[model samples]
Target: MTSETQERRPLFKPVRGVTLAGLIGALAFACGVALTATSGWLIVRASERPVVLTLLTAIVAVRAFGIGRPVFRYVERLVSHNAALADLTDRRTAAYRQLVPLTPARLGTKRRADLLSGVVRDLDDEVDIQVRVVVPLITTVGAALVAVVTTFVVHPPAGFVVLGSVVAAALVGWIDLALERRGQAASLAARGQVDRVAHLVASGANELGAIRATDEPMTWLAYAQKNVEKAAFAQSRGRAVGVALALAVTGVATLAMAWVLDGEVEAGTINGPFAALLLLTPLALGDVVGLIPDALGSLARSSAARDRLEALLTQEPAVRDSGSEAAPNETVPHLRVRDLTASWTGEKTDLGPVTLDVAPGEHIAVTGPNGCGKSTLLAVLARHLDPTGGTYAWGERDVRDLPLDAVRDGIAFVDDDPHLFAGSLRANLLLARPDADDTDVLRALERAGLGPWLAELGEGLDTHLGEYLVSAGRSGAESVATATERSISGGERARLGIARALLSERPVILLDEPVAHLDGPTADAVVRDLLTASAGRTVVMVSHHPIAFDALDRVIDLPAVTS
Candidate 1:
């Protein structure tokens, strides 16, 4: 989509509940103004020694207005909150769906946790604008109009004073919004830095301490916090100016109304009791206008957030599905790539114009230096990324011509950092093959060299794996912080990942440095067991350690990029 189209899109589409809430809010504020003005009129008339029966109407009206204000406000709060929450749910779901296709390629180089945090925070800021800015602004304007018109019908000069005061308050709100917009971008950038630093510190504390790099990350955290404080102080100054302007205008308008009423009373244009009502009208209305500055600040923040969300959602996916929907052969499929080149960004090539071929049921190992394109090749083969040049074929048919889902269904790709979800071992393994029973799961685990580890587990397949550890003796384990301490060893984790792939039962399996963190002996043993378990399936393994495989059919070595 074009930038112009995104700019024209509305952030908050009006909901029915918000509309109802807005009407209720306006009525509530109007009641507050009426309560204050009627009470003033009633008190002035009472002091003049009027009969109690003659004052009954004003007395009853004052009581009704006083009681109605809180009631309407309570209903307004419930309606607006429900509407905002419903809007938040829909928006979050849409944003997540848009992000799925982008995945690792377009999300940038930031840590996954930091990217997710920013998305969540931005979504909250966008949704909050409805309650904070839109509904309240509607209510304030509606109440102000009622105040101006009512006072005008009673006394023209008092009406003009109230109108001028409201205009001045609006001017202050606009100026505050402008000032907030200037600082909001900087504040958002600082907030992103803080999130990145905080996520790194929280998730990698052990690694940093082990490498004696803890002080460096701490220094970065301090720097980000300083920027956040500075930005907040600047934004706060704008809000303060808005509050002072509102107060000053309100005071001026109140005194001006009193002066006009004094002249009108002497000229017999308005009675003494009626003059009291005009004098207090502006004071009551000023309270509603006082909320304008903060509402505008929220408007500025949410506007920024909306723009960010639009930009992210409009990004084109790295790989597009082909027009053709042909399916590959269901049986074990052969794989071939001739002069294949891939790029994370289309502007430059990151992976080579390299070539390889594998017959069905063959085992091949790919090894290269750090900057080589082993993992990039695997991404292209798995259809998670697009190839910039040449061709990749499955079962002698160009993979691009096949249905995207059909091509991906034939292969299982496991990387070094496989995520273990917060669930039981059975749940984790079942994700690979949902139809697989406990017997199938145990067989896959045993084949992947996890039989010994499974035997040691007190609950076997029922052992809870992540966040909260559960065993036979421990029935109340809820400490997520220590879950990692109870996790399996490096080799066991690698084998579990392999077991997941084995259980997939796909025609082709691609392994990307799955044992990179294990010791030399463990790495060799894991690779040996992985090959044994993946027998008769077409397998491709990428490793930096390059363990010798007795049953390996072929080896492909990638050359490093020179320039």
Candidate 2:
């Protein structure tokens, strides 16, 4: 890796707020240990019929430690969680900015939904390391040190026992780290595969069942699940060993401390009450030391997550903006592709050596069989993918020389699957043109043939959509409103997508099989409305259906490539 690349890699620096939280947590653990030891000493001393005044100080101290432990823990949780959440928000924004240039191309062959889900999961895991792994590790180490030093001050031999037990626990933690590291990669891969399969099966259930291919995806899901289980089982062995070793070491240390105290008390080297406190110290300290092994496992998982995120974000963009080019100026942009060929991966050409020219306000359709690169051609034209060979020009200037945002702002792309967020009808429409008023949205809707539907709505633009309408129980006016929102058909969805594109006011519009999922009649009507609505713009659509071929000014038919 180049020095610049190395410098660009994300590093998790310790947050001051989190460090403070960890310190508080360490103090809390220490307080708990002191409370246990002090309480034991108080009880044993009281058994000898000591005066009430003599027990007063130890009683007050025990009560204070007991109360401080929970209070400090609560404060630690609040500070650490807030710091982690704030860090998560900043990292998510930066990571998304890095991912924008890599969309639909460098994000790999996995389903886009799966890839995006992985990014969210990995980012969450990475951020959680601060709270789950880092803070706990710091707190454990700090508390253990305090326990060792305090016990050593009371009884030198007992202090050494506590130190030896801690060293043994550290060795166990090291072993846990090695075991987790061995399975981390495999575990991550299995998780990704399971996520991919689960997303595919859920999102495409209807389509797969329609084609009777449900069994195939289910088989793949089962295989992925088995691998995930296997990895989990293998990783669990390390945790099990750590837990067993912790218990055994604590038992041995407690016994050793008790035996040494017995001899000290018998020889009059220490008071009977003080011996009780010294004997219970190791048991209290064991609680803090036991956390280290579990924290190590969290460290391993977070490390894996960070590595995956870095691997994805470090890739070079498929299309780089020259950064020194001027915007192209054309009232109605004209496009020319001469012998253009492109690839998702540079190793194989998926699109054309074929050529075409699009004049201003021209309506053209590119039709081809599946895998014949119609969508690939549209992707290249939309500047989402870069051409490996040939020249693509906009208004007589090479597109590669134009600023990326300039080119993108002049063109609008509507894909086969357009997302509808859960919001009011007005809110959904305004996403296309945020500054547009209700009148502008209605005009766009009418232009795309939703005039009749809009007129029939009782709430007009205020009608609620998405999950609320689907799940809510309704009566009277609510029932009517629910019916109105739920009445949107496949044809209306296509028109809504076109309406959004129209609101962009871009001179060139690219549609990639927008009506592919509709029935024949609905698809034909949608295509007709789209062509009518976008009459003044240059519309280049890719489709295999012959619904609106007669309406298009020209049609380009792509032939299949044979090796």
Candidate 3:
């Protein structure tokens, strides 16, 4: 939750040298093509066989240069490709960091799966535009133009034809812009639908199976299938248009080039050899021109992706800190919330201008019915969300002005649903403190009551506990069920959550229903451990458990907020 080091561009560094290399490679390629063409013309027109060797030597030199240019091309690609990949990596990191601060406000607005798709798939696809479509197109087309001009010095008609074809291709692209936009829109819609269904299927696979057991699996599956079909239809339509336009242009160019060559040859202005070379130029140039519309459509899709990324980059983190404020370790913060109000801005307000204060070393309980906003209160207190009204101050300073990292480092939160990452238990525990060694890991595991789970795995601390079992002896479902049924029940997960929070050594801890999933004995033990763990720190917890009421220093209840 800490703010990453503030740096100039997070992921995308512009490498000017790559652009230079691409240009050089493209130029060399075009030169090689023109040289080979000129050498053929020389062999055909030479008055003596003695001159044929010179033309043959020119052909060999051109082929050698052509072979070597791919190496330069590879280097150019490597630079741009790595730069793009690195930029995407940084953009993703920044987006995640931004979400950490905005998550409280997002509560029900943003879907994690959708945002994840945008970060991983969409961002990657968009980078393909810059690295693949844009850079390559520019370099090749620019080089083609140079080659055409050089050819014009030899034959004005051929040069004119090349220039005219390029212009026609540009015009074709401009005229088809509207259709391209429509295609892009379709592609975007298809992606969004896919993301929605993917999230639904992933989160509900087990539940859907349960429904299937009731002889109603077809109902949901039928609906999901219909959605998939619709998305596929849209995507297919988009791509079909791109392919259709590309083929249409190629057809038109082929016919037009043949007609042009026929007239030039019949008029005796250019011989069969010259006409042969002229025809070959279009065969190559036709492909180059045909790619224009597809590239534009690609550009459209990539632009949308860029906008998504830029939206994240350009966003102001809900809590912004320049690191000039006091660090977490340097300050003992006594948080006070006076008439603090928060609402889910779009919907009717949920929780309100409730008042509360917690001095250093104080433990407070927030108890309320399901919709009463106990969780919302804790979120606002942790600086996850800004209050609609009133003020939150830490040791007489406005909490908003405090550095975001400072707020995050000072407070540790354990939500109702704890996340277990796909890694070893040791790795999951160390997420809060990556540098934690074996002793610290063992102590944390012991506190969380995960010792038994570790012992069962036999690999102890090194065994993987991801959703999928790493070894044949252990299956994912079996491991989860085993851990839940015996070693770490909901109560145990709660205890583990508390243990993780405790390991953070944060000054303020916010836990939502920490003992809700626990059995009576475990719950009681955890409540005692919670108090002991937060002995000298501020602890604010939300729980409807009556047992929590008797053990706390103070309790506050928030009534549902109204407009």
Q: Which candidate leads the pack in TM-score?
A: 2
Candidate 3 lDDT tens digits, 1-563: 33344443422233444456457546545655555555455556553454566667656765665576566567667766776677667656766765665565543444555466556776677766756566656666776787578658867766776676666667666655556566556556655655565666666778878766524444555666676677557655665665565566556655665677798789998786676566566455554565566667676667677666666544444444545666544355788888777765635556676777788988888887788788778877877766677888888777777687677778889976576656766777777777878887777666655566556654466565543334323565576454432233576567667767877777888888877766777777777767865788888888888655677889877676656
List TM-score per model, in order. Answer: 0.88, 0.91, 0.80
What are the per-residue Cα lDDT tens digits for candidate 1 across 1-563?
A: 22223334376565659878888899999999999999999999999998899999999999899999999999999999999899889878878877876776788877666578778988899888888887888889889999999988877888999999889888888888988897787788888799888988988998888999899889999999999999888888888888888888888889988888897799998898899998999899888988898888889989998888777777877767686767876488888899899988777777888889889999999988876888888889888898888899888788888887788788888888677777889999989999999999999999999898888776778788864445654333743433333646777777878899988888799998888888888888888888888878998888777675556898888987533
Ranking by TM-score: 2, 1, 3
lDDT per residue for candidate 2 within 358-453, as digits (tens), equals: 999999999988888898898888898988889999998999998988998888888876666677778888888899988899899988888998
Model 2, TM vs. native: 0.91
When sorted by lDDT, best at the front, the candidate numbers are: 1, 2, 3
- Prediction 3 TM-score vs. true: 0.80
lDDT of each: 0.84, 0.84, 0.66
Identify the runs in model 3 with alpha carbons over 4 angstroms from their true place: 1-15, 28-55, 65-69, 89-100, 106-114, 175-177, 194-228, 312-316, 320-334, 344-349, 395-398, 468-493, 515-532, 544-555
Model 2 deviation from the true structure expressed as Cα RMSD, one decimal place: 3.3
Worst 10 residues of 2 by lDDT: 1-10
Which runs in model 1 stand beyond 4 Å of their true positions?
A: 1-8, 195-221, 266-268, 451-493, 548-551
